[model samples]
Target: MKRLSLAILGAAALSAGSAIAVQATAIEVTVVNDTAVLETRMPRALSDYGFFTDAAGQIPSANVTPYRLNTPLYTDSASKLRFAYVPKGKQAVADGEGLLKFPVGSALIKTFAYGEGEDRRLIETRVLLHRADGWLALPYKWNDEQTEAKLALVGARLDVDTPEHGTISYRVPNKNQCKQCHSIDDTVVPIGPKARNLSSDWMAAMVKAGHVDAMPQGTGALPVWEHRQEADLNDTARAYLDVNCAHCHQPQGKASNSGLDLRWEQDDPTSVGIRKRPVAAGRGSGGLNFSIVPGDSSRSIMVHRMGSDNPGVAMPELGKTTVDKDGVDVITRWIDAMPEKTF
Candidate 1:
């Protein structure tokens, strides 16, 4: 009887272990092409790869972390992943695809993963061209198949030997950092359709704008969300803010602070700070008055809320753990972008 009990216990343990191994998780990568002039030129975009599962829509009982890459370039002598730089304004039109114009003088290289997830994939990079002519931001684009995407900019360097050793040194941003800001959205929906976990409003707009021919709609399976290089700030940055702050600052949100709102397109300086007094009466009422002190972010209560450790003072109250360094940098840059004079 004792022997029989031991066998049963071992069986139970194995079953539990198998179940734990199948838990699902998100996978992402953010490569910083240091070669790019401005960080802004590196398109800050996230594309959702479909759920990886076996027979069911569940993660396989295998190690997934091995798939992570820390370099901007991938190579496989066995596969054909070539690295090349194409000038911008020059259109590379393939038979079935649309004209993909490299942003004048920018270049890129392609390589394949030798070990895992092997396929001839692109590792395109570009630099933000800030010249007397025009300041060009980062360019990025996504294809329907998440597997196929490209990053293009105004001036980029490829096939150059750098101390980093590889074609590009990749820096993968923390996932929770992104989740922190995105979690703040009212509906918790991503801005773009391909990246969105729910709904397709923006996708419809893209179709309307002639950015794409049709909206991606299918229930068969989650399609690969291709990344679009060279996306406008209106679509990418604004969408990011919407998912990150709109929930607490919108008219319906909990923060009715001094009538200031941070919803998408609500960039009015006067509307961003204290009109009469602080929202919670005396809390952080620095006597300096105004909610967002016009141009000086240091004097603004809104900016203060971002770095505050106080439970009562932190903006987007519940997502502190997820707010990583990258998210903080992006927010700071955005605040800095605000005009000096109240508009």
Candidate 2:
């Protein structure tokens, strides 16, 4: 198997007017040729280089900051922690509608793990690097000992047992699969870190610290997905679906041919999948008549896809190998509570 070690230069290479350098030493990264090599236990793994800090240790890294999204994708029952960092001389520019145009060489790291304390098992670490050539997605599978992670280019599947949910099959997506959801206009982009997702205090601090250029005036904040207990069921369910499905279901996305728009910003109810018929779902529709039925989830093709893990029938063609029971239940409840409407 081929191996590569990159001495990632620090932000000092950029213009001098930029912010303070985030790091002094070159960040070393190990690249493997194939998944089979990573399957074998290898010494001096990716984690040994210290590009990412252990959240459990609570040690502060110069450039890393915990980031939150208004709504996030559901990956079975695993918990996720996300952080992002930019090069020394670069600051992310705030674009319209909460999107931030990150400078080249920025990186976003997300870790997936199950349980807490001694029982905690690190599953994987996904890194999105904004290289000069464009964004690259790398998936690293954590060792059973939690000491390190190895690059898995072809991806891997593992059966894990959870406390709340029994045995579940988890899938780690490959580099190409990452592009399935991250690609927009044929270019890979960051899904999270939108200005609307950041807390008011956090956004203000980011602007004050010069980490970001500035927030658009009169921008409204979006509620965290897990903290929407007080929101109405419809709003909560819409938010969940928007994050999980809108990435591809929107008009500008890969699934635009489906004619369904799941974005939270979409105000038209019919466009939001309410009584909207499928355009090209084919066998995936399960012979259902409408995308959503006001008071009947069993008749809703959207819910059916969410409940299925079959490749031919699933709404999302990649990333997940198992159904999100909690997410399905939420959608089911939301549908059941909807008032019956007449055409």
Give per-residue lDDT, candidate 2, residue 267.
Answer: 79
**lDDT (10s digit) by residue, model 2, range 110-228:** 88888986788878888777766677777888877676788877779888877666787888998778877887766777777766656667767777777778875434355566666
For all candidates in order, the CA lDDT equals 0.35, 0.70
All candidates: CA RMSD in angstroms? 20.8, 8.3
Model 1, 36-72: lDDT tens digits are 4223334444111111222111222111111111111
Per-model TM values vs. the true structure: 0.35, 0.80
> Which residue ranges in model 2 land beyond 4 Å of their true spot?
1-45, 53-60, 216-220
State which candidate has the highest TM-score. 2
**Judged by lDDT against the true structure, how good is candidate 2?**
0.70
In candidate 1, stretches whose alpha carbon ends up further than 4 angstroms from where it belongs are 1-238, 273-277, 281-288
Error of 2 at 149 (Å): 1.1
